[model samples]
Target: KRMLAFVAHKPMKIPGQFRKIFYEDFAVHRDLLDKIFWNLVEDSTVRSLNDQLDQVKAPTLIIWGRHDQLIDVSCVDVLENGIANAESVIFENVGHVPMIENPKATAERHLEFLAKN
Candidate 1:
């Protein structure tokens, strides 16, 4: 609950029904989550993919939350500049998980991008 609040721009907006599922999922995946965290800390080489962004040839749609707490929105600039074929959309007043924050808008953007590409 605390971590969710930290990551979400408006945690209170999260549906009550989904909260239980979220908690259960987290509890089940706790070990996997710990492993992933440790791996990220230990593997310095996997820290950033910025250097390899130029190698991406496929059409890329970068969706980000303007108020993301985990990763600052400024990184979107880096992605746009780095990727040759990249389109980005920043969701205003959204946090780390924009899909959960605003699913309709997020899905619309995804569908639009998919339709074009």
Candidate 2:
């Protein structure tokens, strides 16, 4: 619950129905959470992808939450600078889970990016 709250800008504002589903999913995936989190941390610390960013040939759309607590928004600068064909959109007043925090905006941006790319 605390982690969920931290990931969202306003977890309390989430609709009850959606919140219920989210909690249920969290419960089902709880056992894997620590392993997944540690793996990501280890991978990021041990592996450096900065050199290979230019190898990516596909167009990329990077959507991020400006208020993300888990991953700082400053990382967007590195991505934008590294990838030749990369575009980014930052959601204001949103945290880590932009898809759940602002589904409409997230969907709209994804559709737009898909249509263009």
Candidate 3:
């Protein structure tokens, strides 16, 4: 049931039916992630980012998994509030990388968001 829902997720892509594997595959590089993401994990860094977020005028779409374990979901709310023209959609049962766990839905949401602006 869970797998079917994932497979049914929104976006329909032309070339990469196997694209879901990419996010899962990419996550394997834990060392690199820690090296890069740690800088943004700090409160000062995240808060500082809000200032820049305010300056961004592009239409933005934020897709977050409510159950994400790696990064706190609260950050999504922060980003949503900071960015002026941003929309957020949360997948309640998903985690940090919903793209991997639920590629279809992720793809659908991404395409839908992209089409609007």
Worst 10 residues of 2 by lDDT: 10-19
Write model 1 residue lDDT over 67-116, tens digit each, in one string: 89998999999999999889999999899999988889999999999999
User: RMSDs, each prediction?
Assistant: 1.9, 2.1, 7.0
Ranking by lDDT: 2, 1, 3
C-alpha-based local distance difference test score of model 3: 0.74
Instruction: Please give the lDDT score at residue 28 for candidate 1.
Output: 100
Superposed by TM-score, candidate 3 places the C-alpha of residue 91 at a distance from the truth, in angstroms, of 0.2
lDDT of the structure predicted as candidate 2: 0.89
Tens-place lDDT per residue, model 3, 1-117, is 343444433323534546567656766986798877776677665577667788878988998887766567798988999888999999867876678767799999999988888
lDDT of 2 by residue, 18-67 (tens): 87998899889987997898887898788788777888888999899999
lDDT of 2 at 14: 56
Q: Which parts of model 3 are misplaced by more than 4 Å? A: 1-34, 38-47
Give the TM-scores of the predictions, in the order they appear: 0.87, 0.83, 0.64
Candidates 1 and 3, the one with greater TM-score: 1
